[model samples]
Structures are given as C-alpha cells and as structure tokens.
Target: MKLTRIAQLGAVAAVAALTLTACAANEGGSTAPTSSESQAAALSGNLVGQGASSQQVAIQAWTAAFNQTNPDAVVEYDPAGSGTGRESFLAGAVNFAGSDRAFKVDEIAKGGFGACAADSGIVEIPAYVSPIAIIFNVPGVKSLNLDAATVSGIFAGTITKWNDPAIAADNKDATLPDLAINPVHRSDKSGTTANFTDYLSANAKDVWTWGSVEEWPAGVVGEAAEKTSGVVEAVKAGEGSIGYADSSQAAGIASVKVKVGSEFVEHSPEGAAIALDASKIEDGRTDGDLAFAIDRTTTASGAYPVFLVSYLIGCEQYKDENVAALTKAFFQTAVSEEGQSSAAKNAGSAPISDDLRTQSLAAIDLIK
Candidate 1:
C-alpha cells in the first residue's frame, strides 16, 4: 500500500447548513436548532498521522468516510512502519500514531509525550483486527499444512529443504519439492514481526529461542525485506520462498493452514474475531488505554492465533484545543460502526465487537 494522504479541508454549504428540527414542542410550532445546538455540527481542521503499514488500507477507508461528515477535515497519513510511527508520535512530529502493538507499561510510565500537555496520559485503542497469513511460493504446490514447530524450524533456518521429513509428515498428500526452502522476513522493526515472533516464542520455544521482539533477531537468518509489500514481493519472486504478512496483502500468494488443536485452520475475518475474543486487555493500563494482550497460543476451534491488533495511539490531552477536537473526532469515526464496516469491506479486516467499540469510544471521549 502506498502513502495515504487525503486533504479535504474545505467547507461544504449543505453540510454547514445542516440543522436539527425539534419534534416535541407546544402547539406554537416546531423550531430548527441553531448551528451550535445541532448535534451534526461540522468540524474542520487538518490531522496528520504516521505508522503501521498494516493499517494503510483501513486508514484510506476511514479518511474517506470521515470526510463525508467533516468535509473540511484534512487527514494525511504515511504508512511508514509501526516503529517510526511511535517514535514520530513521541517526538510530536504527528498528531497521532498507528501501531500494531501498544506502548509497553514501562514506556507509558515514563510519560513524556511531546504532543500533550504536562502530566497528561495517552490513549491507545485497538481499532483494527486482522490475521497474519503464512504465505508461500512453491512450484506445483499451492497448499500445505503447517504447525508451530515446523513453521518455527523453517523460519529459523533449521529446515533448509522443502522435502524435509517434518514438512512431509504434515503434508502427506501434497508432492514435496526437493528445492531449497527460502524464508523471507521483515527487515525493519515491525509490530507484525512482534506478533509473529510472539506466536513462535509461545508455541515453538524449543526451536525459536528469541522471545517476542519487534526487530528480527540478528542470529536468525533469512531473506530480509523492508515492509509487508517488500516481503510479499520477495516471496513472489523467489521459488520455494515463504513469509508472513497481513492477510489483506497476501491475496495472490498461497497461504498455509496452521494447526489449531485437532484441525488445520485458514485465516479469515471470522477466524481472526475468534482469536480476538479469546484475548484480554493488558493490565496496568489507564481507562483510556485499551491495549490488548493477544492469546497467541490459543487452540480454540476456528481460531486463527496469528493475528494482530493494530492500535491508534494519541495523547489524552493535547496542547491545542482544535488539535484535540480533531483527534478525538477522528478516533470516534474510526471506532464507529460505519468506520469498522468500511474497513471490513476495503481491507478484509474483522470488525471489532459492539462491546469493544463502546469501550473504544468511551476512551476517545477522554481526550481533551
């Protein structure tokens, strides 16, 4: 996905003139409310956000819908990786940040947000939920069954060939290729990498020694690519190559069915929701911070454990009231039912449940 920048900071007369008519009134007559009294009062301003290439498609959808209501709101976002987004947000280079993972408890404790007033808290809302696909490219082989250990061994560079006994054992029906197995990984620091590594570290700790990390471990060897698209391209170009990425971008690539208890499960919006329902919010977070601790080791039926919960990170209090209003309004739009449906249609992401949406909106309301 390319950088998404939508600048619609000009007023529409029809939207600005919108007013609410009072229905419950005396026999005198119904009266139209003033612009200030109308609940649909339009907002106008520019908002800049950076981070999480995984959210590029969803952001595009969101900005488009946000403009329908707030036509004068300028929304610009750069799909720079997640790490850069967090750093930029902390530095006050952008109004908000999008990250696959929320800031750690220690990082929040430090509390020096440049965009916020002194001693203000931060708000992190899980607005996007998606499954990470294990995509592969092997000639004459479009599908294969992969378990945690076999996947860990392949990515860890322990299993070099496609016809290895471990791989062959799970895929007895498919023809095992004798070609070399090439694994591709993200070169940059990424939340997707964090989620992928978390799953491996939890289920395949014996083979994958490294714990959950945003950066690829130095000792682990593989073909390195810059972002999600780069990894997809690398796997597409290389024969017998495999990589993990957001399911939306893994459309053309052959995906693996990961083992979940007694059955092999494929990645989908429903499957991702199942995995998300099994997760819990992290402890030690403020009411405005809805950071999730995903249950990556889940074996529940129809659950796709390798999923990511992308967050929209912002300050609970901004230095400027206009900036605060714009940020809060945009976040409200993002977590709204309409916004979630738009994302589901455009990005193939699972819509957050009604309960989660209500919680997210309440958190966004805390912004000032």
Candidate 2:
C-alpha cells in the first residue's frame, strides 16, 4: 500500500458557494471528458439517499458540488445510521444508500435491492475514508496512549477506573487520577460501531468476548448516545470520558495513540490511507461489486487498522433510466478527485488514492 504524505494532499475547506463557482466544477465519472461538461449534460431529477452518518459531511460537499453543475437536480440525504440506510434501500424507500459496511453476502443473495430488476446486480463503491479516532475529555490529561486490551477492557466494563493499572502500564509517565472512567458508545446501529468493535474483537478477543457486531454488545457497559454528535457531546459533558469518532470531528478533544504493531501510532490521513490500501475486495462478490473487506488486524507500522471505507451502494440496473443516469452521474462525481478533496476538507478524511479511485470509476461504469 503506497501512501501520499498528508502534508502534500491536505484538504481544502469545502464551501457550497465556492464549489458552485468552480462551475460549478466536477466523478469514474473521470473517464468522461470533464466533470463540468458531463455534469452539465445530466438529466433533471430528485435523488434521496439515507445511511452512514459518518459520511454526512462528505455527502454535503458532494451534493453541493453536484448541484452546482446539475441545477435541476434535487438531492436529500438523510444522515441515518448505516443499518437504517440499508433497510431503507432494501425496502425501496430511497434512491441509494450510503454505508460504512457493504451488503453482506447473504443480503446480496436475497436479491432485494428495491430499485432494480428482480435479478439485477448491485454496485458498491468506496467513496470516503477516515481514521476512527478515540477521543477523550479527561481533566489535566491532554493525550493518552492505550493498547487494544486496555481500551477493549474499559468498554467491556472490565476496567472501571481511569487510573487502572492496565492503563497506567501503557502510560507510566502521565499523571492519572482515580476518577471513574466513562466510555461513551453509539446507541444507534452504526458502521463506526462495527469498525471499532471489529478492531477489539480482532485484537482483544479474550476481553471483547461479545465479538464484533454493529450495535454495541447488548447490555455492554458505557454511556449510550444517539449519533456522532451525541457521542461527542456525551464525552464533552463528562469528566474522564472517552468516545470514538471520525477524526474530522476532533475539534477540541484529546485523542488517543493506539497500539499499532510495536509502536503506538497517532491517527493521520496517511496512516488511515495505508490501512485502506491494505484492504482486499471481499470474496464471492459479483464481477462488478466493489465492496472491500478491511483487515482490522493489520500490524503495519504506520497503518491505523481501526478505519472505515464508507460506500455509496446502488442497483446494477435501476428500473428507471432517469434514476440510473442520475445515480451514475452523482457517483462518478463523488469519486472524482475534487469530490474526494471536498470530503477531506469537510470530514478530516483521507482522500482515496488514485489507484483506488480509478478502480472505483471503472466500477462506476458498471452502474447501468
């Protein structure tokens, strides 16, 4: 996995008006002559997408850029959690779905993508990337270094105190008080939950016996919050509180340095991109599906394993050409360099590498 220096690929601040002036500038949608030209020729329609609150910021940027070019287009994207988005898609209630986790094999086998033909295929494209940062609000502590076991144990309810020996062992030099440790978790079904739990389940199996499931383990010990905002607020409102969220939301909180390989690594766009680069396409997918199976157990020196490859999923063939054309156009735009830069600017996300973006555009072409 090759990584571009985060310094060189820094994100630009995403603004609707600015994106509009860029001609409303730029999608796979890359093979086209140009984004402006292609988007200008798009048909007028309304598209509604639901899912993946994690991608909400990126979606805002993408839609802003999209609407700038296709003025007739109306897009309403609900920041519902991934599960709800998938349910809405499968139920035929939404035009498309934004998800952190792609459709499972069994789900694809059900042949239930609502907008497509009975036996049509589906397409999954990875459009957004970010590190899952563990944020904290402990008084007097500006930073923390933690291993998988200690973190898992804390959320698992095995470690209750902020100054537990396990935690202190990882940070022997830091001053720690004997205050109670409060771990905040998402109450809604979330892709972020799935990634965080997957990491714990992969590295701290003994302590995280509940395994990796989207919703926090039933009855798990932690303050339950509704979404990213709720989780962030919950952590901020309490002392000795720790919560995990996309690094884009790391406005005023201290973040954790997680154990990765032999060294504790701080989250960065380059690190997150390395982990994403290490991912492999999931097996048993149709020829056109672009879903990835991220390996959260990676021990690469700079790769942050706890990461998400958010996706925009749609039918291989929509029943309506207008829907199909609009979906294809928007997806193409979202996967383009400008679209990715917008997301990075707005979400503190790492832009997809050119190789992955090229592959994604090729896959986008399959969205007939």
Candidate 3:
C-alpha cells in the first residue's frame, strides 16, 4: 500500500527521533540516571510505532509514562493514519503499531507481519476507547438530536440542508438555519471512518449502502479532509458543516445526541465504556488477539453506540528479542492503571475496564 506524503514524512521523523534518543542514551554520562530510570533498568532500546492520529494524545501520555521507568528505552510513535500504520507493521517498518482497528481474521491468516517470526501469533489489545462524536457547526444550533438514519442521510448526501425535516423533527427546541449542509469525511484511509461507516451500515443500512469502509466510498460525494484534525478543521471552517471524529478531538464544537433507544444519548467517556462492555470479542481469534466486534445497533440505555476501540498491536514473538522486550514493556505500561489514568486525563478517552486490563497484560506477557 502506498503511504501519503504526510505519512512518509512522519516515518522519517520517527526514525530521526529514534536515532536522537539512542544517541542521547549513549552519550558520555557526566550526569547520573534518575531514580525512575535506575530503579530496575532492564529495558534499553528504541521502540518505534506508527498509526492512528486519534490516539496521538494518548500515545504521548503513554510514551511519557513508559519512559519514566525505562528511561533508556525510547518509544517514538508517529500519528500516521491507521491503514498506513498497519501496513508499516506488516512490512516491519516499525517495531509495533497503534491502530484504531485490529488485523482482521483473513489478514492474520495470510501471516506476513515482517517484525514477527514465521508462524508466530500476534497480540492485539484494545488500549483506547472513545466515542465518535457527530460534530457540526451551524449558525444557531449548539447541539442537535440525531438518529442513525438522519446521520447516515446527511453524510450520504441525501440530506443537503440544515433545516431538513428529519433534523427538525429530532430537535424541536433549536432554530436550525436555512444554510446548506456540508458533510466532511477523511480523505485518507482512517479507522474513524471505518467505525463511523460501520455504525451507519449496521444501523442505517438502507441509507448507507456503501458498507463499513476505512476509505470514503467512491462516488459518495462530500468534502474530504486528510485526518481527524483535518475533518474537525473543515467542520469548524464551514457553516452548517458536519463531520465525525473521536470525541477527545471534538472539543469546542457542537455534537449530536444520538438516539440509543427511546432517548437520545450524548457521547461521554463513561457512555463509551458502557457500549464497549456490551460488545463481544471477535470469534476464532488466537488467545492474544482481543479484537472487539462492536454492536453499533445496540439500544442499551446510556450506551453510546458510536465509538472506536483502538488497539496496540505487536507480535507474540518477534524476530528481535530486544524489540519483543520493548513492545512488552511499553504495552504493559499502556494498559496499566496509571497509564490509563494518564490517557484519560490527557486525551479524554475511556479507560479499559479491569477485566480488559487483566486480559491485556496477560497477552503482553506472551511477548518474547
């Protein structure tokens, strides 16, 4: 798969940062290592990861926390889009990957993760969970109530006006302007798009006929932006504009209250966690793989159906032992209580539950 120029540039930056970190670790030390660094310094190497712009803030927090104990171990992550990140991992361009989605059963069956030894299993942990907010910018509307059908219709280019009857019916309290609605989508292949499209496919199939996809479907016309930030920026710049992004990145923008059952539910970290708890693991996966099959059609009260379960993906066994060790340590730190709290505080993402954390650590332990 061909990476975009931005992704290519990010890859270069990741390598450069790794080189710089290694150089710093090897510098003639007049200064002593800090307590956090010297406590049990078993790890000392660079771990480069790529993928998922949505997890950028969380990744920042995770790397920071991981560096505290393993100061000699550098973790450099690039916020490339998910598809590019997965491709990089499969090509062995990066030590591990952070993706908004896990490798599918079919893809794993093909068995070509270059970082891993032949016949080795992979570890995929749901490390980040966040609601996908339906954000919009309208002249007078601070927020609007929308069902799956209305949301799908608006994005599918069927609902072109801000004052459409479908939208008006959902929000009787607001004065929606008569402006034309501009729907924006990710120009790059994105896990956010996949999750949003999956929700529409599961809940509004009649209107969203394109099915679940990472790329914007061909001929489904809309304004296209490069990443989550791009989509958010597009929506902010245009009047009566609508887009979807991880809730952590949707601050300062008006969002939709999606109808869960009889009541409309606003997106929240707690609500995302509830929806995730209602989801089941994908069947027939290896012990280390924990890919979730989210139930986007769920009508459970207080559950936000639209959410992304981003994963930290690595091999159960790697071609390089040092790579395996760094991946294990970093993954352990990411799923730890302190790590989750850091992410929650920094990114507004939902922390994985204790049961999930236990499972994640168990999977990470398999790395060697």
Model 3 spans > 4 angstroms off:
1-40
lDDT of 2 by residue, 239-293 (tens): 9899998777767789899998888988887899988877899888876677888
TM-score of each: 0.91, 0.91, 0.89
lDDT of each: 0.86, 0.82, 0.85
Task: Please state every model's RMSD to the true fold in angstroms.
Answer: 5.9, 6.2, 6.7
Q: Which pairs in model 2 have colliding backbones?
A: 22-25, 27-30, 27-332, 27-333, 28-361
Q: Give the winner by lDDT.
A: 1
> TM-score of the candidate numbered 2?
0.91
**In lDDT terms, how accurate is model 3?**
0.85
Question: Candidate 1 — what's its lDDT?
Answer: 0.86
Cα RMSD of predicted structure 2: 6.2
Q: Candidate 1 vs candidate 2: which has greater lDDT?
A: 1
